[model samples]
Target: MNTSPSVPGAGRRTDGSSVRIGALVPLTRPGWVEAGRHLLAGLELAVRDVNDAGGITGRPLELVVRDTAADPRRAAAAVDELAGLGVAALAGEYHSVVARAAAARADALGLPFLCSSAVLDALTEQPTGRVARLAPAQSHGWRIYADFLLGAGHRRIAVAAEPSVYWAAGARILRDHLAPRGGGVTELDMRSLDPGAVCDELADKRATALLLLVGHPEPAVSVVKAVRRDRRLAGIMIGAPAGQPEFAEWAALLGGDGTAVPFLRYLPERLGPLGARVGAALRERLAEAPSFVAYEGYDTVAVLAEVLRSHGPDRARIAGSWPQVAVEGTRGPIRFSRTPGIGVWQWAWPPVQVVDRDPAEPARFRVLHTG
Candidate 1:
């Protein structure tokens, strides 16, 4: 339950009044610490920008930071702490599991939670007026990725998936999409099997492409490296839906093997005007380009700031205003959809892309397909 002090200029008020927002980020989780750092960076940048632009009807916009650490219990506890701290709204979570638990707590406390990066459909499945998602659901993004593969003439695909909720949801969506198109997928459990053995199995199936639904960068990178080493699997398209700008370090680890390895991402090679400005600021501040998590963090605050400006720091009003939100976001025009079967108040289109890690320059990536 560690909390960072508010940003220097944030929450400063001439009348001694300020509005506080809660940011739930994974700061100490082993696999998620770096991701949480990137997310927090974007969020802090947005707070600065919001304050500079006359924050929330002339009141300073303050962010109260809490670390979720990839644990549901911890996330819930953090939410409770943030509520006690008197935050008017909540935003910026990375892991879906953590987001789910925090969302439940926020709902119970009647706090407005603007989810930044969690993709689990269940996060928005139940009608919780207090919660809204900025990122597309896992099913929505995976269906789009599956269509991209099919459109590229890939029919016989092998899916290597992790057992996490995130990976399972994506794998199911991809399976559903492929089954209807007369294309089939061979599903492999990535957690139990050896990477080399998995590559051998895919090679035996004569698979045209290997679609990895592994959620983390380490296993995704291992699978990619293993598949590339097998001469028999040469030229096989190795694609990962979760391994893009979020895990861009995997590209550097892949070396030459990184080339043409397609992955889904929200940020494109060329960002929109808002995105470009944020990207440049992030690069200058962090000494590297921001990841998709960074963009999500930025947009979450930007959306919340807009809601606060119109609604005047009322949590109920903020929640109610989400349905009417149609602001232009860095990724695209940000708006939530109320359609059935999708998560409640989930972003209909989050501007996703299928990009490849440039082998010549591992730090850079080129967009191959956009949706």
Candidate 2:
């Protein structure tokens, strides 16, 4: 049976037995379920591993989960709940808006927190920031994706993103990447999953290809449906790498040949011992095998464990320890840096895929042409 741990100010029981670690995640929504599950599973695995390895500072670690439902206000409320529980620190927020809100709350309470999934640039720029990101920022992803597009011989392109702050930020970075080379970029912004409206825009713009920033699978599918609605777009490519499960489904929906670029994709066997081990374990526990984000979560928690063990769980201590601990995670080598302020740019630019009727291995997608 699972049990809650005792922590400092969070009204924990008297035992003082376990060190509580809190995680703010989106668990209630259907669309974000897979991403949320993978992330939480990795954290759960890390907690279990810690206890197996004699726990942290001789005390076992207990994880307290709070469901943010991908809403900022709810995320803020979740932070309050976690902090109220006397958790030593918080970690793992997938969405940037929620993360920003949680960061604000963490700042208010002076709690040290770790955020893995929020990629929006603004989340990292909180004025009294008490947050540390273990994942790449929106700008980094945009730069890498844009660079990939440029390298892949795609000079003229169309763009669309979920009408959220994160994708908006990504669009800006993408614009920067394309403007210098040539002003041949087209922008299409979509906040709805209505396929018809988006498809019309895709045709009207004469977009040769598309880049989407929405993470949800439905929106991605909508974009493809919109594209397919116009028979003329049959040859026009649609690309979205940062968005995952959606990419796979969209490709399948498009008769298994939709184009997609993922932020991370590497066979475990090719990734070396640590990568192989993490990948193998994830396959066993998760109902669905690990995706890039899943491996990323596993890697993030592993790195966090390394940081905490080496520097202790004290927020101040762990913050200082980030500079010293570097690891080659599933996404490749990553380490924190204070200069750029977004932590570290460890992972590689995502991999691309062409949807096929069979869709190939969930792990295997057709590599799109890229530099």
Candidate 3:
């Protein structure tokens, strides 16, 4: 086996024919550990399948896993370490804060980084040829949310947002989209008030819907529970764009209340042939229902493999080739677009759905809208 002397975490195949790729994920964050686990499963499954199918250019693909714990500093260090390990490419990250730092480091090192799930709008703002996002940016997803609410005739909306870059980006997009139509958002700082008090205030405003932009699952669940308490607020629709699918724990936490609470999701019920194949592998191996994050992880690897197949594992060539890449990914056709204000080389269309947890089966959800 061939191993790097400078990087301790580097792995190599027993036969000594392998390409190392770095995986940066949070494994110990208080609220994000489960999300990290699911994403890791997807990446592992993809590597397995890729290797089985003859690997990247006949060289086995090995992942050098790093636990980021969602910290920016740690994430940046992980990138530097992965580069020192001689990884051909980098993939996998969930938190936007961590992704921002890792992306900068990867670019500085001249390595190709395919971000799996971070949605911060500013992530791709500065065009670094080294970075590309597998997931849609926050602004894109929020615009979808805004259109969904407006289509449903919700004019007077109230937004409960967490004080974080991730949440703030989405909130700003929603506000911009709604303002032009004479529909505006009443903003509430989730950190300042109790969940009950926030819901009560929204009820007083006679808000037609409540848009939650919280970063974690716990606060999102708390807000949903509080809104369900007021029978008078039954008419108000509750939607959370950022917390869904990853926050599967909410189903058990909210019980019956989890039903009919709208949240954004990327995975659809019907997985295509490629998605079905990976989904089956994930279920059998992980013994858990595959989430959208898993799909993202799988697709991230697939994209990197394509880059290697075409560019021969040279980081600069792989990074430079992103603009011309158009691969059929697990969700759909993956294509990157360069738009002003959005990140550089960002996926233009990532399949998304508005789903509500099934009332009878809290663990399951039903798709209410799709775009």
Ranking by TM-score: 1, 3, 2
TM-score of each: 0.93, 0.82, 0.92
Across residues 1-371, which tens digit of lDDT does each residue of candidate 2 receive? 11243321222222346777788767777427667777777777766665666666666677888777788888888778878888777788787788888887887776777777777666745433356666666665566667766776777787776677766777778888888976367766665536677677777877766776776566666666667567867767666646553323444555544534344232232456776777778778785456555665666666776766677667666645655667666656766555354532223332322221224554454443232
| Model 1 residue 316 distance off true place after TM-score fit, in angstroms | 1.6
lDDT of 3 at 285: 72
- Give a tens-digit lDDT track for model 1, residues 138-248: 877777788889988888999887777777777778889999997788888776788988988887899999987775566777787888889998878988787543465
For model 3, where is the 10-residue window of minimal lDDT? 1-10
Number of backbone-clashing residue pairs for each candidate, in the order shown: 0, 11, 1
Who is ahead in lDDT, 1 or 2? 1
Candidate 2's C-alpha runs over 4 A off are 1-16, 127-129, 191-194, 246-269, 327-333, 341-363, 366-371
| lDDT of all predictions | 0.81, 0.63, 0.80
Arranged by lDDT with the best first, the candidates are 1, 3, 2
When 1 and 3 are scored with lDDT, the better candidate is 1
Better of 2 and 3 by lDDT: 3
- Assess the local accuracy of residue 19 in candidate 3 as a C-alpha lDDT between 0 and 100: 82
- In model 2, the Cα lDDT at residue 336 comes to 58
Clashing pairs for predicted structure model 3, backbone only? 124-343
